[model samples]
Target: MKQLKDITVIGVALFAMFFGAGNLIFPPQLGVMSGASWMEAIMGFFTTDVSLSILAIVAVAKSGGSFYSFSSKVSPRFSIVMGIILMLILGPLLALPRTGAVSFEMGIIPLFPSIPQYVFTLVYFGMALLFVINPKGIIDKVAVYLTPLLLLALVSIIVKNMLMPDADFPLTKISNVYAYAFLEGYQTVDALGAVIFSGIILMGLKEKGYTDTSSQVKMMIKSGLVAFSIIGFVYGGLIYLGASGASSIPAGMSRTESFMALVERVFGQYGVWMVAVTVIFACFTTTVGLTTAVAEYFSELTNNKLTYRFNVITITLLSYLLANLGVEQIVLFSGPILGIVYPAILVLVILNLFDKYIHFKGIYSGVVGGTLCFSILMFICESFDSLLVVKDWLLSFPMTTFEMGWLIPAITGGLIASIIYKIKATRTI
Candidate 1:
């Protein structure tokens, strides 16, 4: 019974970590494009956004037993390196920028088309820095007002859109709709977020230290299951709400614009302004958590001279610069990076799981080597996307984009890693 109640707090905290305000725009727009197949789209999305996410979180808790502990399998140095890189990627480079851009796109742009975009960007980021440097209960107090207001606004949009699905078909089309939908869902990077977010869950578990490994494992699973349940509910509800957009939204609208249109259509002019404020606040909260966590990890590496406050100032300044680049740019940069990072992260987590429980392999070194190799491939692919009109010529050379180049490389990397582990373990045995 105590465990059940304890699970709720941890579950809710995990929910908040991934529920950053940037998440607001991701699903609704996805659903809008999903057309009649919104349900399929949602299923695909939940795989990355929901399923992998829960697994990552539980995997962390169950494995190395903590974030650093899990990460250490790759070597403390490698772990820290990855942590810093992830923070920067999730911080000023990608996530922070998206928050403000998304808010402006969804909340303010349509309402004031004439205003200079930079003006909004500057103001929004300025407010974000102020809040992040100083997190407090007062903000929580405001959130009490903020969450309900946000939920009501979102609900209003969903209900209205459902009442009026789009008559026109989706402008964007893709085959293997489910697979694409699932991959598209991966764009949000929330699955990666689950690993970053296990801290809160770990803290709760610390309070109930078990005398034995068996008990600890049991507790971790229970807590993880609870967290996954809550997350599943939210993801399922939001994705369904997103896909239900087919009949109502106009064909020409961009994702953010479509969301705002729904807001306006449901609540009239006032709702647009209201949503703007809500989005800015929501974005602020998420960035605070991201920046703060990065700083905390860095401080651990450097032995406290780097302080959370200093990290915030630095990250916020850089994030301000990056955020100005616009959402499309951020998305373009983030995609390939995640491809590399996600695979590396997954391999490491899986290794941690096997080593801790079964005591079977050299999980750490294999992860380190595999990540370095895979990240290079990801970078090469991303470069192709940036430089060439396309990679048709490169595809002929070897494992390329189409014809399953990526698949073969990923499988080979995993196999090589297993062999390396076996060699090391054999020597020890």
Candidate 2:
């Protein structure tokens, strides 16, 4: 009974941590676009978002449950470089500011359009800073109390939508539904969150006396299953709701607007309050978590030269300024950056999972280097008008049609590095 209870708590906490602003906004948009093909689209989205996220937790558990340990298998220098980049992207650069923007747009603007974005963001981050600066039982309490309320609201929305009269799904706007949804899944950023937060979950398990690696991995995987099952249900329901309304919802509506319209359709005027409550609790909890995680990481990295309080203040201020950009623009800006970084992180997660079988250390460097280089090349070519021809030619490369052009380079790089390693070992012998 105690073991089951511990897994349930950790699973709920993990779900709370991952189910934030992006998780809420993206699925409905995918549904709107995919229409009758919503199932295929969601299957692709699940592959990258939920599946990779669960694998990330298992990988971290096997790697001894720390970002540094999980990443350092490639090399210590690579670990620090990768860690800083992950922190920045997950911190002030993209994810943290996004929370404030999402909360304001989804929670505030619909009801209180008079509230200036700058003003709301300032107050939002200010509140988040209070929780982060003096975190105590309140943070845990918020997760325990508010998370269930949020879940109830969401489940109610899903169930209500299901019980309502069905609408016809329009023809899918996308040609390759699966690939488009796979790429769209990058926007959620949960896989990245999973890598960072797995350590926290492992700590929770340790507190429950699951000390050994084998027990820890088993417990973590079970908890992860619990968290993602609920996430998958919510995502599928939201996508279906969006599909049902695709013909009625305006084509030019932003993601937030479309979601708001869906809620309104379900509950009439009362949805305004429901959305407000849902977005506030979801985005605000995420804001506090990201801010504290970023602050603690930098403070420790700098060996107290930059104190935790200093980092908190600086990060909150930066996020506030960026939050004023609003949710749509922040998401557009994040796409290219995530495009470059996500593939590399995915490669690392898969490699680390098979650490025992991989004899050649150079395989890590080769595979990750190949992935990063290919991703950067793709980003650069796509960004430049003059490089259109180059982009076209690169697209002809193997697996580019599937949006995974990095796979071939990654495999080739690993094989070459293994051969080189064997040659060097023979010479040394």
Worst window of 10 by summed lDDT in candidate 2: 134-143
Q: Which lDDT value does model 2 have at 141?
A: 48
lDDT of residue 67 for candidate 1? 63
- CA shift of 383, model 2, Å: 3.4
Error of 2 at 349 (Å): 1.1
lDDT of 1 by residue, 205-262 (tens): 6655544555555666666666567556555555555555445676777656665655
TM-scores for candidates 1 onward, in order: 0.77, 0.92
Q: What is residue 145's positional error in candidate 2, in angstroms?
A: 2.7
lDDT of 2 at 334: 71
lDDT string, candidate 2, 1-429, tens digits: 987877777787677767886788788888999999999988989988888898988888888887888888789999888889888888888888888988887899888999999999989998888877853443354458667977888898888988888677999998999988887775566878888777667767776789998899888888888888888998998898888888878889988888888888888999898888878877876777677767767876899899989999999999999999987687787768888888888888899889999988889999998898889999999889899997887788887865678898888889888999999999999
Return the lDDT, model 2, position 202. Answer: 71
Off by over 4 Å in 1: 1-10, 112-146, 159-175, 200-231, 250-252, 268-271, 274-278, 332-336, 357-360, 381-411, 417-429
